[model samples]
Target: MRRLIKLGLGSLLLLALIWVPTSSTEATAQSQVSEIPNVYRGCWFQPEILKYRVRMTATTFTFGGGYYEQKHWQPIKQQTYRLSDQVTAGTFTWSRSTNTQGYHTIKVRGGAYHVKVSQGTLFVKQIRQGHDINGYELTFNQISHAAQVLSGDVH
Candidate 1:
């Protein structure tokens, strides 16, 4: 009787410990979402053009593309950009300058390039090889059509 009571109490205590952490983690996640900038958080990449979709999330940002060249989706190399809290509004551009000789290469990169973001509009300009790429202006609306595609809401 006493042993049974102790066992039940121990089980309840263990359950409470687990439940507390889980609930706390969930609450913390919810709070972060509220604080996060209202931006697209999902897999996005351009398929028609060689230019890949740049993705940003709470923890990381990645730019890459997939090609179905040989009957398989092959993932291209991606560049990761780190974000700082100081970044308030602007377009972030990224580029790499590489010097290659005989299959050896060195890469120099820049990113989080400031542009401007207003009213949920992201305007991006392209820079290639230390020169601005001509006639290339990329824009993304905050309410993306990509989400519909991802959710199978689009045909």
Candidate 2:
């Protein structure tokens, strides 16, 4: 009878050892989107201003990804326009069930914008400010590759 009891207890401990780690790992992965939003990294471009690159991550929005390591937008025809003195960051909330739809907001020192992105396509709904352009409906598409920065005006 004692042997039977000990065997049962050992089996329960073994089950707990296996179950705890598995559950914790699952929980961490599922909550990663909410905890850290800066996982989306890529180069995006606007049609009117194709020369300037917008590199967006889950955390920060870099206006001139190529021209300047700093944040600014340099159009092909226009001069270098500052986005913010400080770095501009972004945040998006994703649901556990859906990855197709999400809300993205970017707040820079000079400008702020809110967008809704679906399937890698961003629809700009509110453009509070921009270095050159302001308050317009715009859509940014993800480019297949990154662009090279040809010229820049250093601060």
Per-prediction TM-score to the true structure, in the order listed: 0.38, 0.39
TM-score (C-alpha, index-matched) for candidate 2: 0.39
RMSD of each: 13.0, 10.0
lDDT of 2 by residue, 38-130 (tens): 434565666443354555554444554224223443444321222232333433332223323354554443555455556776665433443
lDDT of each: 0.46, 0.49
lDDT of 1 by residue, 1-155 (tens): 99999999999999999999999997875453222133434444444555355566654455556444433334578655444333233322222221231111111244222223446555444445655464554564443565454334666
Off by over 4 Å in 2: 1-40, 64-102, 129-133, 148-155
**Candidate 1 deviant stretches above 4 angstroms:** 1-51, 67-74, 84-112, 128-130, 142-153
